[model samples]
Target chain A: MEKNQILSVAISGLLALGLAGTANAADNKPEMEKCFGIAKAGMNDCSGSKSSHSCAGQASKNNDPMDFVAVPKGTCNKIANGSLTDGGGVVKKAM
Target chain B: MPASKYTFPCVAGIGLRAPHYREVLETLPELGWVEVHSENFFGGGAPLHTLRKVREHYPVSLHGVGMGLASATPLDEKHLSDLSQLCNDIQPVAVSEHLCWNAATGFVINDLLPFPYTREALDHVTRRVTQVQEKLKRQLLVENLSSYISFSQSEMTEGDFLAELTQRSGCGILFDVENLYVNVRNLGVDAEAFIKTIPADAVKEYHLAGFSERDGCLVDTHNHPVYNEVWDLYEHVLKHLGPRPTLIEWDTDIPALPELLNEAAKAQLIIEQCHD
Candidate 1:
C-alpha cells in the first residue's frame, strides 16, 4: 500500500511539471504590451506632450488639420506641419 | 528578366506606423523601404488614404498577422480577398504572413497559436499556402512562428515542415531569427541544426526582433531592440545562408522614427558588412 501511494504521488508530480512547462512556453503578449507602453511614453517624452496623442489622423500627409475629424484644439498644428509625431519618421505637411 | 526589380533594396526600412506618416513623406527619411500590417489598412478612408501617400515615397511591403492558415477551420476567404485587394492597391515589393494558425472553427484566438505539426497539419497548410499564393498571384513569404507548447502528435520538425512547404508550394521563407532563438531557449531546439535544414536559397528575407524571458523559456515579444545573441546568430546566418533582405520589427513599445530607424540602421550595417 505504501509503495503504491508513493508511486502515485511521483506520477502526479511529473504530470504537474509537464503541464507547467507547456503553459510557460513562448508567449509574446505581456512583453509586447510592456514595450508598447514604454514606446508611447518615449514618444510623449520626445515630443514634449503631456497627454496621449493619436497618430491615425495627424500623421496624414495632407496636413489639412481639418481632414482629421477629432483633432485636439491645441495639439494638431502645435506639432510642426511636416513634423509628424509617429514613429515612422514621416515629416508633417506645412500649415 | 530583372531579378532585383522584384526584390527590395539592400537597405534599412521602417515599419510604417500611422504616427509618422506625414513626416516620412515630406522629409523622406533616407529609409530603404517601409512595411505595414495589411489588416490595419484593410478599411478604406483614412488608413488607405495614408498608405497610398506613403506608398508614393517608399517601397512598401505588406505583412499579415492573422491569416490562421493552419487552423482546423476553413480558411477565411474574406481575409484572403482583403489581402489580395490590398496587394493590388499597394503593389508592395513583398507580401508575408505568419506560419502558425489562429482560427479554430468555433473559437478564433487572435494570437498566433502552434499546432501538433503532424503530416495532417502539413497537408492542410500546404493546401492553404497554395490557395493564398494563387489568389494573390505572387509568392508569399511565410514566417516561422514562436510557440509555447509542443504537441506529442508532431511527426516532423518545424524546419522540415517549412522546407516541404517551400518545395511544394513554391513559397519564399521569411526566417525570423528571433523566433528560432526563442524556441531554442524555451524548447531545446537546435538552432544551428534547424538553419542547416532550410534551403538557403528559398529564404528571401530575415526578421530580427526582441524577446522577453518567461519562466524558463523566452517569448518572441517584438517590444525590445534586437538582442546581442540574435544579432550574432543573424551574422552567422548571413555568412552561411548569405545576406537576405533583413527587417527590424518592433510591434510593441515601438520607439520614435529615428530610434526605430537607428535599430534598422544597425541591422543594415551588419547586413552590408556580411556581403563585404
Candidate 2:
C-alpha cells in the first residue's frame, strides 16, 4: 500500500479502537552508571558540575578525546578504558 | 491520544522533560497539564511514541523552541510542517512559540535573540504567525522572550511589540513571567509598563521558569527552581492579568519530579490566592 493509504488505515484503525491499547508496560529502566571516557559528540549526559557545559548534551572535542558514557551500574571499570572521573580533564573537551 | 475536548484548565502544570518521562508516564502524578517541546517528537520516533502515551493522560501543550517566527529570513517550511504533524498526532490543548528570531540570511543562531520592535518587524512577524496558525488550524500562543541585548533602533517596548503582534496576527500570548523578570534586570525594562500595555484577554497561558546568574546577567537557563523575586513578580502579573494556564519549566539540570511538582504547587497557591 502507498504511504498515505497506510497512514490513513493506521489512523483509522487507531481511532476505531477508540483509545488505542493501554499505555505500554511501565518503563522499568535499568540501573545505569556513568562510565567516563566514551560518549560521542552531542549524545552523553551532563559532563559534571565542575565543567562549564554541565547540562545535557556531550561536549564537542576538536580531538578524539573520550567524554564518558553511561553503562549499566557496576560495568564501567570493566570497559577497555573507562574510569569514574574525568581523569583531570584528560577526557573533557574545551567549552 | 484520545481526541481531547478539554481546554487548558486554569491551574499550574510542569514542562515535561525526557529524564522524568518514565516516572511521569508510570505514576501519572497530580499535574495540571504537561507542556513538551514540539521539536522533540517530530519524526514519530520513540519520543513521539512516548508523547502519544503522554497525550492519553494529560492535556499536553506543544511549545516550539525552533519556530523562529520573527526571523528576518523566510519561515522554515519544513519545521512548520513538522510541528503541524506533531499537532495532528498529539492534538495539544494549546500551542506556543517564542516571540524571537533564530534564523537570518546566512546562518541561524541556536539561541532565542531579541529583535528591534519596529513596524517592519511587526508586519513580518504578523504574516509569519498568521501562516503558522493557518497551517495548524488553531490559535498560536506567542511567548515573550528573555533578552541579553536590546536594540537601540526599536520603536516600542517588548510588551508593546507582543501586544501589537497579537492584535495584528489574531494570536494569543503565552506570557513568560520569568523572561520578563530577566529583561527587567538585564535591560531596565519597566515591568509595570509591560503589564499594563498588553491586553489581558490576549494572554492564553503563563510560563514560569528559573534562571541562572552569570557575570551579573540573569540567564533564562531553566536549570534552577523559581526564585523568590520572580515569584513576587508573578504575583503582580496574576493580580493584573488574572490566573491563566501557568507552567513551571525546568529544562536544563532538571531535578526530580517531586521538585518540579513542588514548584508547581507554589504557583498553584499563588494562582488560588489571586483568584480568591
Candidate 3:
C-alpha cells in the first residue's frame, strides 16, 4: 500500500513488457524483418528434408545470414544429411 | 554494501564469458578482475544467477554492449533502468558501455555503428552520457568504440568528444586499447593525438582485446589473442596514462579459462612494469 513500492511494481511491469515490444519494433525494421521472415519460411520449407543444406544454402543466400548469429557450418551439414533429426519431430533448420 | 568487498586488484583481468564461466567459478583462478556483457544478465535467469556466484570470487565489472549513447534516438529509459537495477543487485566494481550507437530513426542496427563526430553529435552524446550517469547514480566508464567508416562531417575526434563528455558529466573513462588501435588503422585516426587529449585522471580502467582484419580494416572482434602491436600500444598507454585496472576481453570464439587467464597474466606483467 506504500506509494514508492507501487511505483516500483508499475515500473518493473513496464520494463518486462518493453523488452517484447522492442523485439517487435526490431522485427518491423524492413531489411531485418524481411530477411528473418524469408529465412524462417525457408527453414520451414526445408525443415525435415535430409538435403536441407541445398535449401538452407540457397535460403542463406537469399535470406539474412547474419540474423542467426553465426550458425556452425557443421550443424547445417548435419541438417542436410538428416543426422540432426529429433525424436518424431524436426527442429526447423536455420542459420 | 562495503565497497571494499568488491575491491579490484590493481592488476590485469579478463572478460568472463559463458565458455570459461564454470572453470573460473570452480577453480577460482587468480584474476585481478572480470568483465561481463551487461545485456546478457539483464533478465533474471541462469546467466544472472551465475553472475551472482562469480561476483563472490572475482571483482566483477558490468560492461554493456547496448544503450546506444551517441544515437540520435531518444534514450532507452527501460535499458537504463535495467542496468541500474543490475548494478544495485551485483554491486559491480566498475560499470562501462561503448561510445557508439545501435538505434537510429526507426532503425536498430543491433551492432555498434559509427556516426559523424559533428558538434550536433557531440551535444547529443554529452546529454545522453549525463542522463545515464544521473540515472545510475554512479560514475560510468565510457569505452571508445572501433568503427569501419568515418563521416566527412566529423568536427571533433572521438577522444576529444570523450574528454569533453568527462569534463561536463564528471564520468570516468574505460579506454579500450583495441578500439583505439582499430580506429587508427581503419579511420586514419591519430592514436597519439587521442592519448594526448583524454584526461589521464578520468581514466579508471583499461580494456585490452584483439582485432581481426576485415576488408583492409581492423574489426574489434575480440575473438583472437591479443596482438603484439596492441600490446605495444597498451604499454605506451600504461606508460603515459599510468597503471589502471586492466581487462583482457575475448567475446567471440572464446577459448578456455586458462587461455583467457594467460592473456590477463600478460596484461598484469605490463601493469607491474608500469607500477615499477
Which numbered prediction scores highest in TM-score against the true structure? 2
Can you give the TM-score per candidate against the true fold?
A: 0.73, 0.76, 0.75
How much is the TM-score of the A chain of model 2? 0.22
How many residue pairs clash in each candidate at the backbone level? 16, 3, 1
lDDT by residue (tens digit), candidate 2, B6-67 = 67888899988766776777698978889888877778545677787788889999888888
- TM-score-wise, the better of 1 and 2 is 2
CA error at residue B190 for candidate 1, angstroms: 0.5
- For the predicted complex of model 3, DockQ is 0.03
Ten residues in sequence with the least summed lDDT for candidate 3 chain B: B1-10
- The list of candidate 3 runs beyond 4 A from truth reads A1-95, B1-3
Error of 3 at B225 (Å): 0.8
The CA-based lDDT of model 3 is what?
0.76
From the highest DockQ down, the ranking of the candidates is 2, 3, 1
**Per-candidate RMSD vs. true structure?**
23.9, 10.2, 13.2
- Say which prediction, candidate 2 or candidate 3, comes out ahead on DockQ: 2
lDDT, residue A38, candidate 1: 23
For B1-276, candidate 3 gives per-residue lDDT tens digits of 123547766788778766566566667787767888888778675567778888887779988878998887899999999999999999999888878888978998676777887878878888988899889898888988788888888888888889988998888999988888888888888989999998999999998877677547576777789899999999998888899989887766667777888888888888888888
Report fnat in order of the candidates.
0.00, 0.02, 0.00
Instruction: Report the C-alpha lDDT of model 1 over A1-95, residue by residue, as the tens digit.
Output: 69999999988887787677654445324332222232334454422321121111111133445655674455555555424444335654633
Estimate, for each residue in B1-276, the C-alpha lDDT of model 1 and write its tens digit.
112333577666767665566557657777778888788778576567767877777788888887887988888999999999999998999899888887876898776778887888889999999999999999999988787678888998999999999999999998988888888877788998889989998998888888776556676667788999999998988887888777887665667778888898898899889868
